[model samples]
Target: LPHRYPFLLIDRIIELDIPNLKVKALKNVTVNEEFFNGHFPEYPVMPGVLIIEAMAQAGAYLMIKKLKAEGADGDFTVLFAGIDSAKFRKPVRPGDQIIFEIEGLNIKKSMGKIKGVAKVDGQVVCEAVLMAALKKS
Candidate 1:
């Protein structure tokens, strides 16, 4: 939450179903966002990579919450290991709020697989299969 601009893709966590290992997150897009300026002035669309980043953020949040709930006492950092089977179905533009939904596919001690989707106005804009590593912070 203390993270700064550009790095912070997640706006809020809407739901956390720990038993299902599922979470819903959001990112509000605005014209004032820096990326729009360079991503293309005439045709501004959120980058595909940023969409993936948003999904990763959701996965990281879920992992942190799960660990803390179990009273695990170690500093941890989550890092992206890989992304697969990613697809962009629609373009996301400014003034749109993207809903990022992610669910754990499998969880290991230090690594896990998750599936994510980015949606806007009830439409899926992008989705991916993500792998991340959780390590000591």
Candidate 2:
């Protein structure tokens, strides 16, 4: 949610279950994507790290929303604290819609962990476990 254009990865939220700490989001990759230009001029494949970022964004969105519902202010920011078990299972190209499945692993006063998976056509493309910390401005 703190990301801006060319950085903001998640396009939309398709499903959100706060009580269960789950969130599903989407991102449509297009030929016009800025990364496509330099990532590869002849053949382009979405960078695996961006897919992980998308998943983390989705996860952070869930945490922020849940925090707000619990009476926390919207002024807090989510910062990536750690990433682990990241695996790239498939290549993502233009015109592909990435689906992010984020499940909350744990949440404390200012820290959280989320297990995230990025999928396309129902196949996993990338996945990772992310840790984040909430900072108030």
Query: How does candidate 2 fare on TM-score?
Result: 0.96
- Which 10 consecutive positions of candidate 2 have the poorest summed lDDT? 68-77
lDDT for every model?
0.88, 0.90
Best by TM-score: 2
Q: After superposition, how far is residue 24 of candidate 2 from its true place, in Å?
A: 0.3
Candidate 1 per-residue C-alpha lDDT over 12-116 given as tens digits, one digit per residue, 9 for 90 to 100 = 999998789999999999998889999989999989999999899889888777777767787778889999999999999999999998998986658878999
**RMSD, one per candidate, in order:** 1.3, 1.0
Per-residue C-alpha lDDT of model 2 across residues 1-39, encoded as one tens digit per residue:
778997999889999999999999999999999999999
Cα deviation at 115, candidate 1, in Å, is 0.3
Winner by lDDT: 2
Alpha-carbon error at 19 in model 2, in Å? 0.2
What TM-score against the true fold does each predicted structure earn? 0.95, 0.96
